[model samples]
Target: MTRESSNPKPSPNDKIYGITNIKSYVPLLLDLDRLNYDSWKELFKTHYIGYKWLYGTLTQSVLQSILKPNATAADVWKTIEDLFHENKETEAMELDDELRSITIGDSTVMEYCTRIKSISDLLANIGSPVLERNLVIYAINGLSHKFTHVVTTIRHQKPFPTFLEMRSMLTLEERSMAKDHSRHVQASHQDNASSPTILTTEYQNRPSHYRLNNTRGRGGGRNQRGGSRGGQNGGRGGVR
Candidate 1:
């Protein structure tokens, strides 16, 4: 996508404390990728559509993480150059948090939470905000909710779901919710054709091999044979 001239760059007057200039942040960014996320760097290249976007996102996330709430654009850029010394992600409870703390941290999280909490004002925001918003939701839910909000939302899961899967899930959530809501409207309209037919089909005699006890977010559980779900989600597509 071509950069639009209408979109203004940060003004010098805007003081973003705690972040570094994109150029100065290069070494630290590379270090972040190598220290624990080396695999992601390669995967970013492998991803065809958003290679540059993912890299820029990594950069943007890193900038947002270190910046304080009151920081200006310059403050953010300046802080980035001097952010942290060692790999402090190991200190964070989840690997994604550790990375995001230095990568996309509280600022991004806060912004996203704000957006989700206020769906009405979303249109006033920028384009294609779902990815970031979904990420924020995932992070927040992971910290609080009872779903498999692991190191990150399943949407952002690296290997199995990939970035694409997250988008799909987000889309699916919207579609499912819309369809679910449509039932009420169909009742008001009294048009039988307006209502969607409910189909609860069961796969007859299906093998029980796929069943396991992976509750939403309470952690592992037993299988049909009552054995521990050793893999713990068994969906570890995370890029280490």
Candidate 2:
């Protein structure tokens, strides 16, 4: 049997901050570029540290595509920028399409709003930030038909609600509608359950001759009076 080595292989650094995509870290990279340009060597040490962290964080495929032997932080940064910056328009269009096509469906108001905000953030990073008014409109348009009244109410507001405020109102409306539907279902079930008992009680309380008396009319009342008078006359004749 071959003897195994007692020393364990070192694990990858878990604490290193990774950049998953090019869009999110552009601002940080730009700040580093400004520092590098000024020749702030003391401050530039931080950039070197960040560069190593980035190298460790990047996936094998990304590293293979962008990595240059003995590359400076600025070099790596420029490579990432060149790759992503060229495709900014395509990315922006895709994000815009995603924003426009969203519908509430089975998602809660909060969930729907969160998805919209996420898409907005991505668009902003690509230099196509959505306007606040347009964001509000997109949110309203994506809601279900049950929210028509809420949409109308929002539209009539003078200043209109912010995204957060609108989300809160919609969530409240969703809860209220759910509560009302629950009550209606419970009421329908109660009515169905009690129907047999109600019918039985009504039948039991009915008069024995109700069916026969129900057909009596104005002529029946006149006949009853005439019979009573005839009975009185008959008694008088018998006495005579």
Instruction: TM-score each candidate.
Output: 0.22, 0.59
Compared with the true structure, model 1 gives a TM-score of 0.22
Q: Least lDDT summed over 10 consecutive residues: which range in candidate 2?
A: 31-40
Alpha-carbon RMSD, each predicted model: 32.7, 12.6
In terms of TM-score, the best-performing candidate is 2
> In each prediction, how many residue pairs overlap at the backbone (N, C-alpha, C within less than 3 A)?
20, 0
Scored by lDDT, the top model is 2
**What digit string (tens of lDDT, one per residue) describes model 2 on residues 60-117?**
5556667888888788867755755676788789889988888988998888998899
CA lDDT scores, all candidates in order: 0.40, 0.71
User: lDDT, candidate 1, residue 198?
Assistant: 32
Off by over 4 Å in 1: 1-82, 90-159, 188-240
lDDT of 2 at 156: 92
